[model samples]
Target: MTIPYGYAKGTVISAPSLKPTRRDHETQYHLHFSVQVADEVWDVAVNVGTNDSDDLLKYKLVFDYRHPLIQTLQASPAGKNDLTDVNALPALDFVRSDLLGTTGRWRDSAVMDGSDTPEPVASLTRLIEKALSEKFDVYVFGRFYSEGNGIHDAHMNQGSKGRYIHRPNSDQNDHNAVWQDGAVLIDCRQPEWAAYFAAFEQQYLPTDDLGNPTPSSSPIS
Candidate 1:
């Protein structure tokens, strides 16, 4: 609940591409891309899986996301946005904001693979490509790097426990916050919005006001 760094907002200038990072002899999982905010191009990393494990239950993604929040995000300013209160703006809160909707719209990466449906990476890439071709306004949300022009954590930011909170060396609990969730939104500006959402199997819904898990919370099935 103590996210020291503020939220991330960017304007897509290039199509998203895959570029994996290596860490400690293991491949860090993510989809890399570039976004333009003003005159600078910032890197964007969206997690595709947990570590190197390709387990389908470990992740969830929604390709054609629809919500009332899309209208607000479509008109938001681009770039790294530092704000005093996220709840007052177009910020996201997966549980609180009902971004996932109630029709079980969230798709599991593994389930998609098993059912011959496009997986998270493929689905996201298709959206970005379409966004670029259609000249749609794209917005990416996450946390910006302190010394670099990039953003990561384009996924759910609450309901983590044990080692799933984050890296081992960091204060795991500090990364969770309400109304500051990470997401990627594509604004067609024609009353159509495509959104990409992700979450680990370990994350649960119904987070508290501080983004902590509640007693009645449950994982997305």
Candidate 2:
């Protein structure tokens, strides 16, 4: 995918790293990039893949700011004195886990709910805007996993367990109408960023066969 924002040129300053996961059978590979946009410093992670052959590809973009929730909590009276020291402040475990995969079930729950507030989609957009205004460097990470096969019944005695089951593929041309699913973050930190996003919506976002914004594929379950 083409990067829409054109603030400053970015460069890859670090090599990729491979790390072992807590799971005995799983491993992960991570790529890092240090970007210099104007005088600002930003870091990005790309192409994060897992050792699990069946895992799908995923991506994340992060910024260098305190988590909104933690910041809010720290301002409250009960947490005010307790978190006086920045180092002693309670870490926003939820945000950290979203960016760096963690074993806690919270991430899974967020994904399943679909309507969860403070969705990553909005967070990403906010980050872009903030970055543009402060000229802070922004980082983006992408990951991919092996697509899973179709669902099956629970039959303990079945000998076909190892066989590959075929599932329908997602239509590339379909654009989900839902805001969380359809919207892409546009670095609207600058006027150009807004224009870029507008152009993308007018040109590439999928439309119905009749040339409308409606999608023609099955809705995500």
Candidate 3:
């Protein structure tokens, strides 16, 4: 769990949208991108939410409009992702698990703001910023900030033990540069792509061989 599930392509140089944050105990929706890979320019972020809103319980967004990062973004060439590291895609905990093929859309963060709250994380942050304004293709994990690098634990890793951001503990404060957070979002455009994932009512569906989340303290349901 050293955070590193790569797959890149660039654009949106410094972010200007994607909001809906709470910070201190979670409720995310971050943004930031500067990807470029093969010529270096890494610095990404695309966090979705869950943590505040009472740990955002009662969920179900296992989407996958044809996952596999959308068949690798309809077979490459939009922002970039010809498989560049993270052991060649598929398994950085495979985007919130159940191995793609998801479909349970019914979300309910206890009526986040009532009024028939159908925000669905602001409708998937407007389809992940309409697939980041274009030239899409991005399925990152976390860590590796060679000066503000991005791609955070988008969501769910399992049985959090307290670290701060959605899950991470071990005395945090960068507990030797955190790891095993969670995330599984993809934003493509060719014929469609979107798999924004989220998980936190404090995770833990068994993990350990480096996938972290093997401990717990209960009370987060």
Return the top candidate by TM-score.
1
Model 2: how far residue 9 lies from native, Å: 4.1
- Cα RMSD for predicted model 1: 4.5
What is candidate 2's lDDT per residue for 101-156, written digit by digit as tens? 32212111012122213233243334444544555323221111113211111001
Q: Which segments of model 2 are wrong by more than 4 Å? A: 1-9, 19-27, 56-221
TM-score of each: 0.76, 0.23, 0.29
Clashes of each: 1, 10, 14
* TM value for model 3: 0.29
Ranking by lDDT: 1, 3, 2
Give model 2's TM-score versus the native structure: 0.23
Query: Which sections of candidate 3 miss by over 4 Å?
Result: 1-4, 10-117, 125-139, 142-154, 160-180, 184-197, 202-216, 219-221
From the highest TM-score down, the ranking of the candidates is 1, 3, 2
Which ranges of candidate 1 are over 4 A from the true structure? 4-10, 21-28, 51-65, 111-118, 163-174, 215-217
lDDT of 1 at 149: 84
Ten-residue stretch with the least lDDT total in model 3: 170-179
Which residue pairs does candidate 2 place in steric collision?
45-141, 55-145, 55-146, 56-144, 56-145, 57-143, 57-144, 57-145, 58-143, 58-144
Better of 1 and 2 by lDDT: 1
